[model samples]
Target: MSETISPAQFHRAPGVTDWRVTGTGPQAVFAARSLGEASGLVAPVVAAAERFGVRPDVDVRPEAVVVRVPPGPDGIPAAATDFAAAVSQAAHELGMTPDPSRVQSVGLYVAQHSAADARPFFVAALGYEELGDTDAVDPLRCGPQLAFNPITGDVPSRGRTHLDVFVPADQAPARVEAALAAGGRLVDDSYAPAWWSLASPENHGVDIASWTDTTD
Candidate 1:
């Protein structure tokens, strides 16, 4: 064969913050270095989360920051009317527009409380199967996966999780409203008619949405 050379792969800095844009797709993956950095990107995602009734969690690591876009039927569409608003807010907060070229795969996680009897309820109610358990680590689900762990006191300020709930989308709105009727208050009202978050009876919060795109 004739001598040929392939393009070299460029290795980016570990945890480099980036905004993922691919082929007019609906998902928007954001990467960053700190909570402060991710704040710039939070507004649009938060608004979308509220409209779609999903929660977008801020995946914070010492090395990098990640904002995983929630999926739809219940997920906010990549082209949401409020999308730009959210992004602009983040831009103001970050002091720069996030680099779109450095995007990476999204990360997902879940939490419960150490004191709560959540395992049985998760398995039976949410259809989450057990994966494994450790003394320190919470029980994990390998299929229809569930990441059950002790609540770390409180959710991060201006942050939430893109959780998967085993409920119908049409039913989500009513369920959420009922929770409110039962005295549950909204975490934020920025996004509506799409996703609305509410604190649960146990004070553990859940994002009620229409779809289940979790890695179960």
Candidate 2:
């Protein structure tokens, strides 16, 4: 069983908002209207983390900069609060916005006849290491987590590629509701407490997931 962080545990830190606390760490995304703005934030944020003796994993995309603070002795929430505050201050000074709603972690799904047969190919091709028996993850914590799902029967019309969007456990219900309200449909809830499958109007699949135990 993986360690799970609850909303209460995450929210205990003051001034930390919009950060999704996971088993590994706390993550947040800052939105940049332009690539230049996103680029500008990297140095200052990195410097700030270094000043605090923490190294954060940062991914700067064209529209956003995602930061994840790994768990330390001070703990993830504390470290994340410090990192997020630094980044938020830097972003504000640069006229950028911290969009907590955009904070999400994605996992890639590959439907295969047998995970045993397919896992090795992806592990070698992507230079990814195994996380569990069926999942391969980026050692650098940059790329999306890859999950190989066993498909024993004929392939579905929807295809093999699907995405898992991980959010805080407390936020899952609202996220699911928002998706359904936005013209999406529920595909399956049989995997609840782990994930809920949803399909877009175009039938593209996505799963809304929570890292914490949601079995209750």
Tens-digit lDDT track of model 2 for 123-150? 8999999876778888887788898887
What lDDT is obtained when candidate 1 is compared to the true structure? 0.42
lDDT per residue for candidate 1 within 1-216, as digits (tens), equals 222111010012122223232111122334456666655455655765676444454544433444543333222343332343454345546655443333322212355444554556556765554445611112331233445556567543323334433333234567678778897878864554445666765675655543331111
Which segments of model 1 are wrong by more than 4 Å? 1-48, 51-54, 62-64, 73-81, 106-216
Clashing pairs in 2: none
Clashes (candidate 1): 18
Question: Model 1: how far is 108 from its true place, Å?
Answer: 15
Model 2 alpha-carbon miss at residue 199, Å = 4.1
lDDT of 2: 0.73
Against the true structure, candidate 2 reaches a TM-score of 0.67
Rate residue 200 of model 2 by lDDT. 100
User: What is the C-alpha local distance difference test score of each model?
Assistant: 0.42, 0.73
